[model samples]
Target chain A: MSLNVGVIGAGAMGTAISQCIAPNTNKLLLYARRKEICDDINEGHINCEYHPSVKLHKNIMAVNDLCDLKDVDVIFLCIPSSVMRQTMVQLNDIVSDKCIFVSTAKGIENKTNKRMSEVIEEETGRSAVVLSGPNIASEMMKNLPSATTIASIKKKDLEIVKNVLSTPKLKVNTNHDVIGTEFCGIIKNILAISQGICKGMGINDNAKFAVFTKSYNETKCIIEKLGGNRSTVDDYCGFGDIITASTLNVSRNHTLGIWYGQGVYLDEQTGVLFEGKNTTIVLKEICDKLNIECLTVNFVYDVIILKKSPKKAFYALWEKL
Target chain B: MSLNVGVIGAGAMGTAISQCIAPNTNKLLLYARRKEICDDINEGHINCEYHPSVKLHKNIMAVNDLCDLKDVDVIFLCIPSSVMRQTMVQLNDIVSDKCIFVSTAKGIENKTNKRMSEVIEEETGRSAVVLSGPNIASEMMKNLPSATTIASIKKKDLEIVKNVLSTPKLKVNTNHDVIGTEFCGIIKNILAISQGICKGMGINDNAKFAVFTKSYNETKCIIEKLGGNRSTVDDYCGFGDIITASTLNVSRNHTLGIWYGQGVYLDEQTGVLFEGKNTTIVLKEICDKLNIECLTVNFVYDVIILKKSPKKAFYALWEKL
Candidate 1:
């Protein structure tokens, strides 16, 4: 079926999502909050903040007003988790009810600790699908092949998403375990930061790999305890994304981990959105509320919250293992 | 308990394994076929081929004769899989019957398709323990922290091994699933090569991550089908080792994959003994003989054996996923 697609947010992830959807859809709409981003995409087919070299498809229309995308059949919510609620409220005031909401955002809300899809469904009053994976936006802009998971409880929505987003370069897999998949994406960042600490402590690949395997196990237990399928952590969004983010130096989380390893603490005070650091705080809160003991999570909390030295934390973790 | 240790082979892995055991043992004996290597370690306190920088412990004695290790309490079989049977046959002719054998070898035997532990038990008439992990020889030589899995059917032997090998720099986890753990170590090389192909083709991290997740799933299924624990593949030797080998550019298998991606074929004719290349053929053979269909293994087989182009094989794999 021919589809009218709209993407919210003009950031790197938003631009990449627009490029992925642009070549296949009948008409593509990009609603950027900033008029300059909208004008730039509309006039020059570029989003310099995300990708400076790649030229976007001509069919991608940039719009500043949410009302301009009311006719679209699907809206890919690409805005940050901090602003997701407000963006959804604005779209709900103008967009049609039939439009399917698919989120590319990879985080839990600050106050409610709710996944982005939950926020989408609550605000928009529509069933939503969440897409997450080891997708680095810069690579997508280069048309490099990558795999992602799209999760929705509804079978029909999954089929539609597969039909819309699947391309030679972007392979999409469908999963019904929305909670498990979302949690996997969120927790992997914290694991990457831990790995960075291992690197900073001058531990070899062996220790880093052990930490990775243990993190996956620990994350799986936490997810299963929370009523999500454990196998979902073994999927692209969980294992795949963590491996990619942890190994590549370009990731913000890994960078934060490197700094953490070097005994430098980074917080919101740095004006950096190191999602793993924030995720650690949220994850620890959830674990405590749920009364589950995750050793890796606890160790991370000790380092990030209790101000334990990275070397001391590493040795403590080794002793525990 | 005070233990006397003996290590076979003097290659990089053998040397590193000897170094790991030497610092903890009452006395360490290294059996090297090359007189120069034995003399180098004993007289000069250096294993030039494996580790040139680190000085070996004074208690570590090197010998060129297999009979010199006959009185040792335990033997760490660090030989290559290609010569495993031959080496075992030689050791059996001289070593005592009560010696506990711990193997650091990490491949399935070529012609027989048996694991090193299986060959060890058959030749030595004793229960065997196997060790595997993301323990890169060079990294281990540097005394950088790393983790390894030590698996044995006997609980007492595992404890003894833990006492003998566990050091401040290297962490060892115990497991009872010998077959599954060994297979995990053997198959990870093939996965590394596949990852290298993704790199050579310039595929993005997302696709590579997806392929990795799929490969792990496929490998786990194959192990379970063969009467091994499925969770073993998720352990340090399986998941952790693959992550280390595949992500890093220093691995031989990844290098082979890179060459394959560039349309450069690597084989024994090229004077490179890439374990992953040999493993793909053996794994495909095992799957066919067992009447099990592994899509990832089949795709790798087609790429290596059927002379299918790497790009086409990659696309075929994506289509299957």
Candidate 2:
């Protein structure tokens, strides 16, 4: 019953997911873009760069060439969203026609406002399954108890991915709402930044959580408007991930927002990219076109993008409440 | 334009609420059962026991007798849910017939299984306005930014309470879903204990938040079954308060769950009176009678009430997920 699985990228998430599903797969081919990382994972039995203390599973074989994935039953696209489309285009020419693609990236195209699944669909000429939840890669690497939601339009695809992802330590829930699953990952970044901004401005706990409740409902509204089930937002991908990213200090986007809230602007020269910054702009545009007014999106946009005074933007949001 | 308002109970919540609305009232009467606290507030302009640093508003006058509330336009019942019925019965004879009652208690009568509002109705023969949210007393005492949801069957009552409670620092959202609002306060205790048990058991973030998401949706389901709006769970009363009590360590129920999870059973002698413990027992009975199979409630009952191993109960809950 085991399938041949391949995971693209050797970053934290890519390495961790490979570790999670290696036991369920006959052969887990983890595609590392860097030659040294591939060699280290294959020979040393460890992802030395990201997860040095933990050893990779015996079933996981790190590969540097894309051709090694031609026989995989499924390829998980763990690359950054910025490179997802091009990676899919390259991967489409190599993988078999029946090979299913799973998107773990949580970003939309800058200009097209297309989700990662849409990008994979455009490039692969097939529907893509999405995997998302309150997963922290480091925790997954340690094999701590975790759970996630996998979604696809095809029930068969969902069944396969669910089987591959679920283990005693890692639980997976399957659903048919692909858009909701993927957008949950995207919208959660905005929620994180909004909460970070509130924390940065030293907003009280009651006010912060009040705004969080508003943002949570707005997420359901936006997802429903995009033809996804509103109740999907109550799932692990939506509520679970949103709380994890927003409340915990682990997310880079949340850290970025804290800096902005403190009026310390982090420029691009820092070399750290925040998908949430781009997400705020893109979501603001989406809400504007749809004539939907979302306070969370606007608050993050004003403080982070427009560089408005954090106190002023916060008071404006509180006034609306 | 200003109405006479009275707040019963000189506890932290009562004094803080009085401070919040004193600006909007002509004469704010805060009823303290203890004669010394009443004298302290009236003579010193401070509830020295509950809030020593924050000065009570001059418009607020502490009263030692129930007769002092006779002419008040609105009365807020801030006493323990255990004393709520009897207090209402006493005030029923003193307060004017046209006076509005607001219940800030977040408990259900143990034997009767009636909510605070229902208890008020039984004792006073009036529809009591229900006020609940992620309101922390200390923060509200300092007039820090806060928001709350008030629900009443009557539109006029909601409007009047909203006007009295609304301040630049305190935002108020009014709704007609009194049942939903009342149940939200009652249900959040279970969520707090569940999350606290998870934290005490050292459950991973992914697993904890995944169970949290499930419990949240279950809250909506149970509320709906109890003749409340499902969407009302998304308001300040449900999502806001649930997150506040569950995530923050300020809640006694959360700390109690932590102790129980760590295998430290505290007897009634150490009792600071955790409302969550009683809430867990009552909710289990209610769910059993209603034939609602809720995993969160069951998990909490197993660990806290039945004295089951925290790890065993959590694993059982995770297996279902």
Candidate 3:
């Protein structure tokens, strides 16, 4: 039997999910925030901003309201992480209590200081599974195989999510440790930015490779110390996602790092939203309270967010190391 | 003044390390069993087998006699792990006492079933340090800035090794727990081979991503069980090396996996003398004896070494999982 799938946020990820899930299942709906994005996808059969290659299925529905997602068996929250908290607030009012919600967005709420899954559970009084990994929407839309982890503290929800999403072109492995998966996704950005800063400082490729390796180890260290299962950071969501994000241009965070490597300011490099920036903001505060070794991340955070030169921040961090 | 360095083996790693160190110090020697290879490197100034782009320094002598390496401050064992047990006996007799030693070779010694550093200490009375983490030999000679870990159980030796190896392009970081770093390096090869098997199965990128992430977690689990500190793997030698080995084509282990993915037999794909292939043999034996739940690695070992078909291996593995 085909599973019912609903995607909240008709952005790149939502469209990508819709495209990925549509070939197998009949019930697919893409809920867009703005009337224009909804109309745009419905009329043009593609998400212009995220995936131009995606051809919407005839059975797929594109709607502007959250009410459209009411019947979905699996609801994937694909919107920006910043707005996810508020979006869940509205989703609580509209969506069914029993729906197996999933999040594709990888970020923590800056104001509420909540991960997407945490935000969802708080707002809707239900824990939803999270789907995240090295998912570049463009590659996925083209039918390139991609993998991610579907993690939830709740095993039943995770299995349900794994069943619905575990298809050939896309696979969602199950993990009970949501904190590890979420932490990896958020913390990866900080290191990528640090790598970018190092590259900008005329550090050669070996130096870059060294930093890349250390950053991964350092991030894993931080994750394991925070009561996360060590395995959580070892595999797909943790290592694969982190490596893919920091190494390739596919990641917005990594791209910002590359720009930072090229001596561009964080604000100028992004020109769009990056959740790792906010994650870094919270990360610094968390490090101070937790007493973790975070000068590398702190250095990049200052250079990118505070408009400091990459050099000054880099020297500061390297000196401490 | 920097210590004069002697790299035993005169292979890919030995030559590369010699070249990288020679640019900074006058004391560089390459030891080999074959007169021709030593002669070619000394006379022709090229490492024909390992890295061809870089030239051998004039002061760096390539000698077939172990007696030539006696005056060196540090002698690096760059031989394969499988043969290190037998080879170390010979080296133990030839090399001087109180000489600092390091190892570039990665693998668990098959017979004694020990890490490279342990093998060095067992064979020779002198204790050893590890030069590990993402230190791709040829890449380092290109003057690409690279960083790696120098680790010993002894803090004083670790600091001494770290300081001597520190150069502008080749940086050295320190980690105290070698059991973690060495285990991370060897176990990751087993994971890389598994990754290859997955690629051979035509799994989606997401599945691969998922598997890759999970593989590390499994590695960490085994390492922790082995009584290695998490911080060792959490630093350059553990997680960093895994990322580099799994992702880069420079690693023959990962390449062996890529060949496995392409439907070639393990021996045919590896073309003999691949460390990852030997790693498969050693890891499977260790996991089986220890009752470690290492399905991914064990499954690959079953397929590649035990003559099971890839499909058969997968079915058995999936069932157990």
Highest lDDT: which candidate? 2
Better of 1 and 3 by lDDT: 1
Global lDDT for candidate 1? 0.83
* Cα lDDT tens digits for candidate 1, A1-321: 779999988789888988886888999998888888888888899886677788998888899998999898888988888888998898898778778888888889996999888888899777689888988888887777778888899999898878889888788878899898888888887887787777776766777778778887888889898778888887788878878878878677777777778888766676766667678899999999999877778777777777798878877887767
TM-score of 3: 0.80
Q: CAPRI band of model 1?
A: medium
Q: What is the clash count for each candidate, in the order shown?
A: 3, 0, 16
lDDT of 3 at A182: 83
Better of 2 and 3 by DockQ: 2
How does model 2 score by TM-score? 0.98
Candidate 3 lDDT over A55-135, as tens digits, reads 777767788888877777888888888788878888777767688888887788876677787888888888778776778
For candidate 2, what is the DockQ-based docking class?
Answer: high
Minimum summed lDDT over a 10-residue window in model 1 chain B is located at: B265-274
TM-score against native, each model? 0.93, 0.98, 0.80
Per-prediction DockQ comes to: 0.65, 0.84, 0.42
Error of 2 at A199 (Å): 1.2
